[model samples]
Target: MKELQQLLKKFFGYSEFRPLQAEIIQHILQKKDALVLMPTGGGKSICYQLPAIYLPGITLVISPLIALMKDQVEGLIANGIPAASLNSMMSDSEQQQVKQLCIQGKIKLLYISPERVKAEADWFLPRLDISLIAIDEAHCVSHWGHDFRPEYTQLAILKERFSKVPVVALTATADKVTRTDIIEQLRLDNPQVFISSFDRPNLSLTVRRGLNKKEKIKSIVHFIRQHRDQSGIIYCMKRSDTEMLAEELSLFQIKATAYHAGLSPQKREQAQDDFIHDRVDVVCATVAFGMGIDKSNIRWVIHFNMPGSIENYYQEIGRAGRDGAKSDTLLFYSMSDLIVLRQFAEESGQVEINLEKLNRMQRYCETDICRRRILLSYFGEEVEKDCGNCDVCKNPPLRFDGSILVQKALSAVVRTQQQIGIEMLIHILRGAARAELTEKGYHLIKTYGAGRDLSYVEWKEYIYQMIQLGFLEIDYAHANRLKVTPLGTKVLYGKTTAQLTKYMPPEPEKKKTKASTGKKGFKAQPIRPIESESVDEVLWDALKQLRKQLADRESRPAYHIFTDDSLEDMVAQKPITLGDFNQIRGVGQIKLEKYGRVFVSLIRFVLKLPKLEG
Candidate 1:
């Protein structure tokens, strides 16, 4: 255990294990199967990577994307760890070289995709002395998971092929159902399940309701301007939306690029590379763009549309604030987006499950309660108090005794035999003289026209609230009809009351300038560096510049060289000697030997201090 900690500091440069990382690593070191559920940036990699170094044999990592594998391998090698990747992007000779390195026991860790493993496992498994297997993105194996892939199911063969080897399946987001499915599908043998708290306090969550296209663009522009010189990602629903949004951002002189599967492989790779290198400030992309990204300095994430599920939203937002710094996440929600997502869910093969997940995501967007509480609750983690960081907690909305209104809606559903959806129910409540209502005799119900004082949009909002409150549910299997839950029955019978937030329509977005022009009309604004009270601004800027130079010279991401957190540590500690430099967080032995003196010299030069011997 002491050696493990030493190796952790020597290789990964961390003095302590994050949460359950140490326990998970120790269990794996004992040659046992385990299931790990930790949030992004929670040090999941270290659990398997560290054990591989001590286990005396190579650890095989099954990853989902080539870019992800590449990033991990690059970061490992930069830390002076023996790591290599085999992917379709590599040539035959390159693949052969990596295989030979593995056979000769020169490489301690080997990363390959599930598809590659499926094709080569039969001939490949027998050649290497396998110590352990690490399955990343393990949620993809479960049909109940958000991002299910058929290829992941084939991985069950690993336990069968290597009966004595330990396997660890790790993921950032998975519900109870998905976790169970993963264990079953992967055939893990009595695996120890370790679930870390699914809380990312550094990320501030906000949802903007009812924004028009122009208003959303304006909001995005304003946000980017405020967070100038910081890296961000704007996620769109479609490929076309990515391109259009990228162009819109560029019109304001923001260094933005478009990324999606529709683009050529080279173009996608270039976009990713530029973003990782800080040559691009933002990447407007579809969901496909960020799954494999490992950049640690993303200061914000913007959702251009509602995601299909909370899992997807959580995973995407997890990309930001990875360095555990303060970051922001903004999501724009509109009725049209909800409608589109519902249609997609209905069209899916798993209609009931998908719609249920989509409804939860909708509730997340519409709820006036703490967003973080809702997010944590979805992952089965109980929080007694609201997270003070979310917009709802920061600025709470007005609430009123809405028991009468709830009874009115529930009574109408009962009068109509619960045969109506949200739209139809709203129409009936608002006394709309529609032909379908007249044909269905809904206008004559006793509760009909009871909610006529409220506008159509207000009623819609309230109904959605009721759905989120568990008083009502949408049955996707039944023509998308609304059904009263047992909770709703209580409300109808006056057994319990409910509190509802007052519906406030979005204010009109003030147009400051033309869509194609900047805020000052054509002249682009200069990006201001982020400010911190504790950090010395001048030294921080210098360290970033030096890090970027080293990154470009080595052809690696700036964060790969030294994350922003490390830079801040340097600014605070102002280490002047090699010994002091080694004390900085993330400064491993190899890094201290490789780039230690240069950083020490920069610190001394920037602070105008006299040079000192070690």
Candidate 2:
């Protein structure tokens, strides 16, 4: 334990672990299977990483994303840990070398995709001294999860082959059902489950309903412009929509690129690289764009259209404000979006199950409470205080006692035998309709014009509120026909309280205000150029060339690993010791230990030159 603390301080420089990290680490050290349910940016990696550094044999980390694997491996190496990733990026020869290192116990950790683990053709397992297996994003194995991958089913086999070896499953999002699915599929026997709170206080959440597609696009652009030069993502429902939005953002002088599966592999790689390098400030993409994107400073995430599920919505928005810095999350919803999404669900051919899920999502969109509160509650966490950032908390709309409203609506549905749709029922209440209602002579009913005091829009809003409050529901297979649940029966009998907020549209965008730059007290440092052909410059250039060749061979953009600015900064700083490197910005203690030695060697060679520093 003392040695672990000393190593933690020496490498990562952290004094202690975040909540549950130590417990999870201890569980692994004790050789126990565990499941960790941490929120995004809750230090999920440290739980496995700390254990890997101290344990004998290589810790095999199964991850779904190659980019995430590379970033983490680079981070580990920076911290002076011998970590390597065996992904598609490596050539056959390079892969063989990595496998050899793992077998020889030179590498502390080995990161691979689950698909590679399942592929019997891979010789990674045969050669390595495998200790512990850590599954990052383990929720992908469950069908109930948002991003389910078929290959994850084979991960359970690791338990059989390496029976005594411990397996640790980690994920950022999972509810009760999904958690059960994970335990059942992986056969985790009473694993030590650690679940954390989902609230992210620094993120301000808001939902705006757009009248049409153009207005929706304008709203998204407006939000992005408000937070200019900041990192963000704009999610669209379709690939074509992503392209159109990216083009529009570019025309507005916003730095953005499009990413979707439809794009060529090279283009998608370039787009991700550009975003990570800070060359592009925004990425307009479909749902596939950010599965495991680890760039931490994203300031905002805008959903151009409503998402398919609340779980997906929360996970996507959770990507923002990851740095624990203040950020914004915006969602655009329209009544028509329900129809479009319903049609899409039908086309997927999982008509019964998918439609049921979409119906729940629709009610979530129409809910009038604090949006964040509803979302968190679905994840099995409760927030007693209303979040001040959501639409309901900011400039709250008026709430007429919905008790009477619910009774009337439910009575009308029950009186009419619940056969008609909302349009006919609403028409009966309003006492106004076109020739179709007149032909049915529905106006003769005693409930006719019962709600005539309220306008058509007001009645429609009330029905939506009722649906959200669980008084009414849609029979998905029956052409989405409206029906009252048992809860509706109780509401009609005045057995329940229905408190609903009337939806009020958002105000016009506020005028832009100029922000004051940080020119007070602190002054900007001037850059001094060194003379040409310094020995340090030669080594820096050599490293850059090596990176470029590796990036090219792997079909990845070079700057993803080290930005040009970061490289230049390293050259300028020429840190001679780990301490010196740690003191520099962007040179976190881990990074200094990983790549610092080679750069320090180059600096020492330069300082020995007669024409240079001396």
Candidate 3:
């Protein structure tokens, strides 16, 4: 175990493991199967990568993204570890060379896609002395996952073929249903499962509702301009939207590009390569664009349109600030987006699940409470108080004595027999005299016309809040009926009272400024350098610049080479010797042997530290 810790410091530049990583590695080293649910950029790769180095024989990693595989392999090789990848993009000679390396016991880790694993397993399995099987993006195996792949469903063969070999499955995002499905689908044998916190404190969450196209585009442009030297992505709903938005950004001289499944393979590859190499400033793309991208320096992510689910939104927004630096995400939503997304769900053949997910996403966009709390709650994690970083916590809405309005809404539901949908109940509450309503005699009810002062949109928002607060329930499968829950009944009978935010009004256009243009209806806070009591801010920035320079020289993403957290550790410790450097959190042995002297000398020179006598 001490040797493993030393290896972590020597090779990966980390003195300790992230939460659950060391335990999972220890479990795997003990030949136990495991499942890990850490967020993206949570160091899931290290959990398996480090164990693969120490475990006898090669560990075969099953991943879905070729680009991700390439990035991992490059980083491993840069760290002086023997790693190789086999994908369709490799030439026959390249593939044969990789195979020879594996047969010669020169490669410690081999990354291959699930489809390649199935196609080549027959010939490939026997060539190497396999010790462990590590599966990345394991959520894809579950049919309920947002990124389901049929090929991933066939990965059960890994455990079936190698009955004794321990398998570890991992993913960044999975709800309870998806987690159970992945466990069953992968057929793990009593694997230890670890779920880390879903909260991303470095990511500032913001949401805007009903932004017109012009405003959204302007807002996106302002965001890009604010971070012009940095990288960002604008995610749209449609391919055409990507192209159009890319053009709009280009018109503003932002040097933007578009990427989607609609683009040709060559074009997509070019865009990805350019973005990775920092040739492109921004990418206006659809949700399909980010899953395979490994660039870690992305400064922000802006959703030009509403996504289908909170899972997708969280995963997409995770692309930003992967280095543990402060980053921002802006989501623009509208009612028409909800309608279109619902229609898409109806056409998807899995209507109930899709609609349920979509409805949750809509509620998230419309919620008046703490955004982070609601998001964490959806994934079964609970935070005690509001995350002050979000817009709601930053600028609270006007809360009124809404008990009367709540009683009216709930009472109208009962008076209408609790048999109708929200629209009908809303109509009755507003005292609508439509022909059907008149024939049904809904106007005669005492609660009829009770909410006449509120508009249709206001009533809808109120209903949404009621549902979120557990005051009401939607029988989604049964004509989408509105039913009063126990909480609603209490409110109706005066046993409970409620205070709700007033109806949302149209937001005035904000005057664009350096720090205020990233999000609509809100201003983005100035991104400050990482700070701690033990370190100087200017020195920390210098260390980051040094890390960036090293990363550029190696042609790797900055974080993949050395994370911002690692740099912060260096700045804090101010180590001037290899021994002292190894004491830093992320300073592994390989990094110390490779670039330790340069960093140590830089620190000594900058801080005027005296050299120790040999």
TM-scores, one per candidate = 0.83, 0.74, 0.79
Better of 2 and 3 by lDDT: 3
- Look at candidate 2 and give me any clashing residue pairs: 77-594, 78-590, 78-594, 79-590
Worst 10 residues of 2 by lDDT: 516-525
What candidate 1 gets wrong by more than 4 Å, as runs, is: 400-535, 612-614
RMSD of 2: 8.6
Mark the regions of model 3 whose C-alpha exceeds 4 Å error after superposition. Answer: 226-228, 401-549, 570-585, 600-614
- lDDT: the better of candidates 1 and 2: 1
- Tens digit per residue, CA lDDT, model 3, 1-614: 79888788667776677788888889999998998988877888888998999998999999898888988888788777899999999999999999998988999999999999888878877778999999998989988999999999899988888889999999889999998899899899998889888888888988976566887887777666656467888899889999998888878888789999989999998888878766677898987788887677788899988999988998999888876778889999875577678879999968999999998998889877899998899989998889998888877889887888889988888887887777788798788878877788888989889889988768877876787678888775667788999988888889978988876554544554433222221112222333333335545555655665676677776666566667767877888888898777656667777777777766775665876445
lDDT-better candidate, 1 vs 3: 1
How much lDDT does each candidate structure score? 0.89, 0.75, 0.81
Q: How much is the lDDT of residue 546 in candidate 1?
A: 74
Give the per-residue lDDT of model 1 (tens digit) for 39-75: 9988889999999898897999999999999999999
